[model samples]
Target chain A: MNAFRAVAVAMLLLGMQGGGVPAVAAPANAVDKPVRIDIRNFAFAPATLTVPAGTRVVWTNRDDEPHLITSAGKQFDASRALDTGDTYAVTFAKPGTYAYYCSIHPMMVGTIIVQ
Target chain B: MRDANDSTNERRRHFLGCMAWAGAGTLWLMKGGVLQAQPLGGADAASAADASFSFVQISDSHIGFHKEPNPDVAATLRASLNMINAQSTRPDFLLHTGDLTHLSRPEEFDTLGQLMSEARSGKVFYVPGEHDVIGDNGAEFFRRFGERQQAGGWYSFDHRGVHLVGLINVLNLQAGGLGSLGAEQLAWLKNDLAGRSADTPLVVFAHMPLWPLYPPWGWGTDDSAEAMSYLRRFGSVSVLNGHIHQIQQKVEGNITFYTARSTAYPQPAPGQAPAPGPLKEVPPGSLHRYLGIRDVRHVQGRQALAVTEEVLS
Candidate 1:
């Protein structure tokens, strides 16, 4: 009887551990942060921004003319003209400061500070 | 000595030629002026006013447009400016009703700034069009022209006994392409006009049509009626807007709504095209004739605006 009770307690512990596994694992994969950048009138919204590493930043064009989101040193080029309501996103896997501007309108400059 | 008579004969011939040319010129002048008279409406009234305080209304000067309808917008603007400068009564100032630049690029803005500075009228008042605030993060326009303006480029001032109100409706343009006036600005406008009596002549200038010019093109403001409600108490109200690139006028009660032509290109009339864009190429020189400026004059407590569309042929 003693041995059987001990086995039953072990089974209860396994069930609790199984339930906690999902809870712990769920948090690791559940959080997603997306940053939005707006393009209008030849300028960028939040001309300056800060985001955590691995955050996805989306750019949407709201102006009539075509625009581009290209990194300052030509590291990444979203060369296509993003139409109105169209979005372009880039995930910052590595932490760094990225300065960008619309290639079509160079005067439209913005900075994304990633930490 | 024998050729003296020949020289006299030559001089006589020259005299006769001049006489003939003068006769032809007189006939040509009669025909030309007669043709112009047919379309010259309100000429008698205009001529009666010996002293007129007239100002120029330039709307939708969408610079940076490289389309066929208005292949050379800057040139057309220059032509319009020249025409305005050459008018018999030089306008006191210029009122630009928005969409100053096509995409609001700094270069485009810079270019527009340079061109406007060159205008004969040193004073130019502006409001924002939906296009002007794209990606500006809400302050690009103010940084350039908001030194004296209130609330993101909306302001009021008195000019020649006329109360001019410039409103900002293009910020955060709605999804349906409607212009919105935030609660703060609307309240400010209401308070701004609260003290004024009914006799005060008010002129409201915005980028989008304050009335329903056309909804499909997103030409009209969404909350324009609310804005108009504030103006109903005024005896004389004139609301002018751009963004449609055509001339349309409506009179509701004591209020008059006028949409000015774009100095850049012509868009199709409402319901005339599938979508709003640069119209097809009209023959060269047709655009300037179609697009120009409006001249507004206030006389004897009456406000009359004469639109002179000059095609740059």
Candidate 2:
């Protein structure tokens, strides 16, 4: 839990700097795209993720059921029912901790830390 | 938690009525004090045709849902249409309780419309489910089906001397579970039924169950009791709902409450699973057993509507 708080703090600091350090020192051959979060078996593959600001996270519903990505504070971000093979992408322009869940199934929660 | 819920739902399923899964179906006809399971095609066919009018009910078609126990939901919906088309005496119209589409996508609605175009019934009535209004405040759903209705998208009509009300209870979800029909709709409902005679049979359809079928799973509507208060005087009343993705019926006083099965996929019986979502792990070929629609037949002189559960056999 403390580690999560530390990450949240770091992301907060980075967000203040405006689009924190590049998510990764991209290799010249790497393609620039959003990080993928797969919704399968009613849960996000990586329950929690840390990425740099200006990084886009694309959530793909690979399960047969529909899953949504809604931030804790609905005003932050929310997606349509992400049906099978449907994808929702949002760029984390501001650094902070965004806790989201599939509003349909509140148990399926995930966290994304923007650094 | 799941195990505990499974046991509770198991007991509740037995206590309420026989468990009618997707396959081992049971359609109980209640008369007086006798509750008996009758075949889908029983001797009541002729009687059902003589004095009664029938309307096919298909709910939670969930048109864009492609996953597990049943991946191709369109096939099940097509099967429902086929059943409706093949009805011995054609039903008057179709009533889609709610959850027409999984994600409320335009293409999803397009697919639903494309499939519905082939249905035998020309008229299909719909109310928005939480899934249908996941993101927008039912703007898209209202754009498609909420026509000439009040601002909140609720209206009532009459068919065969029975007053049928389509109520919207999914607009404002409270605390993440259970639907709420604001006071405005309830007032409209009360006013709508004010002038009607007490003998008028009332049928109310919504996406969420009006009665508190199960609060833990968000299966019931919060302010539906107010809506029910208006219809309490009616001699015969039936409430049709979807979203639980299974059929659970209750007969109280003069009213009968029924939740419909989904044409897309089945959810765990109330509290059977950790939460109410699609049920996976069921064998593929047998999915049709759990996915089907309800057929309601109202004999003109009778006080009850003979409800039947016909699966995709």
Candidate 3:
């Protein structure tokens, strides 16, 4: 755990430099563990999720068809079209309820609550 | 073949086309914007030998798809083209209603284009399915297949006295809604049909059904009622769509609606299954029975057009 903290600090310092760095990368911490949401049968598994702010959420497409992620209220950037086995990730840095749906199949909807 | 016998042949063809799915091969004849189903291989089939003009409609090719009930979509699409090529009278043009690719991949579209070009059929026209516009808002799709870029892939043309309109209703979709035509396309459609003679026959082709067939399954369009209002002026309006991946028909007053079967795998009927996706539980060697093409014949001075369906098998 101490080594993990050290690496996290190092990444923070590098990210602080700003140029050519992924500054928004999730910090290394237990609370920040990435969450996963699966897309299958044209619906999102765990249609609702609640997590702490700054938690990274990963969406993986497992259905035979393609899906596109779009924020219902334009809360965050929309994802590109995800084909079978393709995955997309978004990090929530603020506390708010985010509702989204598959633009390709708009009837498929899900909600994410970041507290 | 002359105009003298056209009305007599039209009446006979309508009788044969109204047998109501009498056999496995169902034939549809659309008259005055209404459709009647009949059985194929009937003795009266030769009555339509001299249709004024004929075209073929194929939908949901889904070229990149590799799934059960059909693991080889390319083979099925090739089979579809083969069927079209073998028609006794070659089609004057082909209308692909949409979902031409499984995942909107470049190679998927490439495969479809190559195979379609090789067919002896006439010029091919296309409308964007939801799948075709997945990424970059259909930039790739329009670049390759769009005839009118400024019009946003929707265009109208006159063919042998019939006005055919290809519409794009799969873009700018709203969340938690069904297929949409947006305000822009709706305005364009209203103007596209303005001041035209009501006597002109109209054929409107889109990716999804214009009427609200089933809202739960996203099988209908939201603003389609507005679009339909524009079509009500015409005496004969035949609306053709292909997204449900199966054949379905409905008629509203002056408009007749028909959905074509996909060249790819089959999809469950509305609310038949838990949700709408691929149907993988078909018995062995029965997939071809669910895939087919639609043949439409327009006879001049006749209010309705004749539609014949041919399965891949």
Best by TM-score: 3
In model 1, where do residues sit more than 4 Å from their true spots?
A1-115, B1-52, B289-313
Of the true interface contacts, each candidate retains a share of 0.00, 0.24, 0.82
Instruction: State the displacement of the C-alpha of residue B155, model 2, in Å, after optimal TM-score superposition.
Output: 0.9
TM-score of every prediction relative to native: 0.62, 0.71, 0.79
User: lDDT tens string, model 3, A28-65?
Assistant: 57555678999987788889998778879999999777
Please, what's the RMSD in Å of model 2? 8.3
How accurate locally, in lDDT, is each candidate? Answer: 0.62, 0.69, 0.74
- Model 3, residue A27: displacement in angstroms? 13
In candidate 3, the residue pairs with backbone N, CA or C atoms under 3 Å apart (3 or more residues apart, or in different chains) clash, namely: B31-B304, B32-B304
Ranking by lDDT: 3, 2, 1
Clashes of 2: 3
Q: Least lDDT summed over 10 consecutive residues: which range in candidate 2 chain B?
A: B23-32
Instruction: Kindly list the per-residue Cα lDDT of model 3 for residues B90-208, writing each as its tens digit.
Output: 66788889998877889988998998897786698899899898777888889889987456778889877778899988888887899999888889889989979988889899998
Name the regions of candidate 2 deviating beyond 4 angstroms: A1-64, A69-75, A83-115, B1-20, B23-44, B289-313
Worst 10 residues of 3 chain A by lDDT: A22-31
lDDT digits (tens) for residues A1-115 of candidate 1: 2234445665677687775532222223211547788876456888888777777789987765556676876555554546556789988777788888654344467888887
Candidate with the greatest DockQ versus the true structure: 3
